[model samples]
Target: MELTLPKKLNASQPITLETKGLVVIGVNGAGKSSFGKCLLDQYGSLAKKISGIHALFINNNVEEPISEEENEFSRLQSMITERLFMPRLSEYEKLILHLQSEEFEAAVNYKEACKVNPDLLPPVTKIDRIQSIWEKIFPHNRLVRKSGFIELASGSRDSDSYKAERMSDGEKLVFYLIGAVLCTPLNSLLIIEEPETLLHNSIKNLLWDEIEAMRPDCTYVYLTHDIDFAASRPDSKRIWIRSYDADTRIWDYELIESNESFPEEVYMEILGSRKPILFIEGTDTNSIDSRLYPLIFPDYMVKPMGGCQKVIETTKAFGQLKDFHNLESKGIVDRDRRTQGEITYLREQHIFVPNVAEVENLLMLEEVIKTVAHRLMKDPENVFNQVKENVIKLFEKDLESQVILHAKHLVRKKLETTVDRKITTVEQLAEHVEGIQQNIHVQDIYTNIKNEFSLYVETGDYKNILRVYNQKGMLPQSRLCNICGISNKESYLNLIISILKENKEDADAIRSAIKESLGI
Candidate 1:
């Protein structure tokens, strides 16, 4: 059956959902639960809602068996108050009644067939089906059906059995889920809110896989904030709920589509962000770019996309997605030996190339150094000057090698673009290679880079040196931390971050200096 999404979710067009199911994911306060409630209301009798935080208490009171009518009524009422009341107890009772009825029918059928063929196997009841899955999830525990009640039995010993009500929260939750799913009406839409709640990572996927297999006729819609859980269901269509306007009862959301440029996890992270995305270069959260860029660009959500190429590719790919026009995206990659023409080209493509060779060098910026020094109550000018002298001295010591590396990088970048992929024949390839060999002047490139490097050192232009230098150890080597009375590079970085969070003026000054160097 096709389910059209609520109009407020996407007023521009109707989004139809297929029987394959859809996973609605978003950050907390994004109204995912509200969206689930809307679906329940829309589908009415065709849908059944299962809360993630269902009351796991199984009321094991030995009382009169509830009539079918009373059972149905209790189940319906529990659906509305399931978040608090012991709703699953009603379903557990229903499961027990269904199992007993099945057993009686099987016994009657067996008696009649005894004369013909007494070797027929007993039919599997709903509880038996649930037990099969339960055993797999909890290897040490077994489901025991005794005296018309389901109880948990420790391995190999019925004497160790305990009432279902006494089961641990996790165990009780699992049983409740199994019973609820088994008791659900045929072909109903099962809307599970935060299915990952109280579920261990190792078994969460397995439990859902088994449960879905048991009810192949039902369409499953999972509303959750857990990206990993959402990602585990590969076939489900993923929708990111951006926000909800309670006053207008409208939701701002987007469907997350698979892209060749990004993995599912990275794509979800990007789509899940509430702020405009700024893709930066870093491998992980511990990287300088990941930690520093977020504080510096407080207005945008800074995502570390590992290497420079990935950042550039992801940004361009994101921009091309016309559906995501509501979210603006940009990328920042290190300058690292890029010529002015290449830098200008990248800028035009919305990829900002900073004047600093790499992000680590940003810490060595003259203004940033002074900001930290002043914050520590040191002489900003003196500290900056000493740091500047140390950095220049270090750069001079490695001047020749730096020039060689820069020239090599530029040559490699140039040659990488010169290869003609369109050339098909060996003859054409030979001519292309010959043309590159004849025109390329390695000595000229080296001499030009060396001259530029010498000029920066001679002028003692701290900013330009940072722009051209690609030293990861520059900050520690300059002893700027020592000059400011900070213990080390890591501590110094932490201090900068703390200052940015607590001191607005210092943050703005640092931000301005970095932005100026980036020409942003």
Candidate 2:
């Protein structure tokens, strides 16, 4: 279970491959395959010391290459049949005789019996272990048990059986993996690379299910760059490898099981398009990153990172990935009470933090509100003031919740620094009640937070608040939602989108600002 490679390995700490699976991911040439090979070699040498330590390395390279002359179905079938029967070549005629007789069936039955239950008596019969596994992996594909051999029948085939060479790459790989698993020793390690190469999502799931059914019986070490696949296997142990020199070699590696920290290739794939990537925060329906940025900056691929920190990390990560070094990547995050110093530093890093409180705050503009009312066939003069009043009132009601959340965050931050250093023991927990009391002064924090929000909520001053919010940028959240109390039937953004019909000048102004941000 413990593998120690050469000093030059530059590998991470010794990895323990127990019942828990391991996923190895890195960029191309980042030592993924090399790491796997090194482990396999080490595993082979320690086979005697490590009990039940057989290993199977599965590269996605197709073993059976379709020959140029073997274009015909019969030719391909003959080539495959010859390869399958190669091991029994000495008993070729005898084996064929037995295959024609009932003895071959008896031998296969005994093999199945041993697979199903190793505790069964000698010369066992009446078992269907492989059949059961095959069913789980490819339920629709027919497994034809002919007198001569076992073959997989495609559902679309006109004949009774399918030529092995005729199957799709995915089908072939599944067949290869299942066959390899069946033949491997119990408690062996199965190393698979690039499982997503040709397999569809559904087939990949089925293949994984069959592998999982193997359980503690056989361990799996998957080398994959596919994020969705890794996300599906949450219980598995994950090791992310990184290199400094364009994946020429490994520089560092760490055990990062968190999906949030997943170094997915999709990032490079987007940047690989050679287009500017506008990385932004938020992934939900209400997010401007997901909903509106694409329309505004049509030239750039607007990627939605899970949060502000993720966007920052990803933007930096792109610089490290040398292949994508030329990519013009920019990130934008909400202005969440950041200090002037922090805001200045972030802008210098090409990461924009809008002047407004958030995207939502910038959208609460009088002109934008009037546009929405006009689109809805209401008198703009009559409804503008009402909408403005409602937005201001909503902010006032939301102020307490916001203050409470911020205070809680600060308290937790203070507690984290205070707890372990001063009050470590369980016995001191009761005596340290004063620590919590001293750190959390909710009333004082609430007063300051209320005063800060007062400028934004005061009546007749909403337009001025928007003006100040948009000081650095023009209509920063013009495409964002304004009204907070939107219903299931219609969102505030949807209303604004409708309003764009009556306000061509406003739409043009917003688009111009967006283009300026993109440097288009």
- The lDDT leader among the candidates is 1
Model 2 accuracy (lDDT, Cα) = 0.57
Top model by TM-score, which number? 1
lDDT of 2 by residue, 102-192 (tens): 4466777877989989887754211134455656667677655655655667545565785444655555455545544544566666666
Q: Tell me the TM-score of each prediction against the true structure.
A: 0.83, 0.50
> All candidates' lDDT scores?
0.82, 0.57
Candidate 1, 33-84: lDDT as tens digits? 8888888998999988886455443444535556666777786575578656
Question: What clash pairs does model 1 have?
Answer: none
- As a whole number from 0 to 100, the lDDT of residue 127 in candidate 1 is 71
**Model 1 CA RMSD to the hidden true structure, in angstroms:** 6.0
**RMSD after Cα superposition, model 2:** 10.6
